[model samples]
Target: MHLLAFNGSPRLRGNTWTLLNQLKRGAEEAGATTEEVILNKQHIKPCQACESCKKTLVCRIKDDMAPLYGSILSADMIVIGTPVYFWSMSAQMKAFVDRWYALDLDPIRPRLAGKRFGLVVCYADSATETASGVVYAFKSAAAYFDMRFYEPLLVTAGDRNDAAGNPQALQAAFALGQEIAKP
Candidate 1:
């Protein structure tokens, strides 16, 4: 099995990254080949809404995102990790999500169809509900694409790298990864 994780936090060592790393470890232990894409290090341009890819199956703007398209398409499982900002996902993850429009050129047929989807979110607020929008976005997309959307792991009260110190959060991430590895 091949699992691909996308870390959408700007900070490489932030809470979001910590959770994703733990998850990756678990997936690897389960015999899945796991890879992580750090969005901050990649030059992924925002979707221009030009709709060119709707017919060509390619993006007009050529950059680091070009390679990720193949990764996203080939992965058996996809995990999206992000930090909650203003009751939603960070700008980086949102931009990445927007670029997925390129894969949805056909309303009935999506490139990521039938893949397993998971989400990991870190938030400062005690109410993890603040990340509901991010959850909804993934859930909606998964449903539209006939993908399997797993229950998300939300780590609340995570500031900076606080999640690294939270044993429960780390365990949850690991467990989620194992679940994703199952056939």
Candidate 2:
């Protein structure tokens, strides 16, 4: 299986990054090849409402996002990990998601239909409320995109590397990776 993970946290060593790495380890152990893209590191322009891709199956803006379209198409499972900011996903994550409009074309819809999608959200606050919007965004997007949505892994980590110290959070992420490995 080919599993692709997108890390949307700006901090390269933050909780979101740690959880995604642990998840990657589990996926590799399950005999799946994995590729990861850190959104913060990439130069992605915000999606314009031009609607050009709706017909052409391509984005008008040329940048790092061009290649990810192929990666998304090739991967068996696509996992998106992000840090919650102001009760929502990070700006990087939001931009990445907005770019998905390119794949919303009718011809490409079948390619994504029933594909597995996983969400991992990290926040400093212990309350689930802090990241509910992000969770809902992924959940609703998965449904609209016709992808098989898995239960999200929501973790609370106040420190940058706190997720690495939280065994439960790590295990949950690991389990998510393993689950995605199944056919």
For 20-113, candidate 1 gives per-residue lDDT tens digits of 9999888888889999999988888899999888778678989888888888888999999998888788888888888888877674256677
TM-score of 1: 0.95
Candidate 1 overall lDDT versus native: 0.87
Tell me the spans in candidate 2 whose CA falls farther than 4 Å from its real position.
Answer: none
After superposition, candidate 1 runs with Cα above 4 Å error:
107-110
The prediction achieving the highest lDDT against the true structure is 2
lDDT of each: 0.87, 0.90
Candidate 2, 8: how far from true, in Å?
0.5
Give a tens-digit lDDT track for model 2, residues 38-126.
Answer: 99999999999899897677899999999999999988899999999888888999999999999888888688887789889999898
For candidate 2, what's the RMSD?
1.0
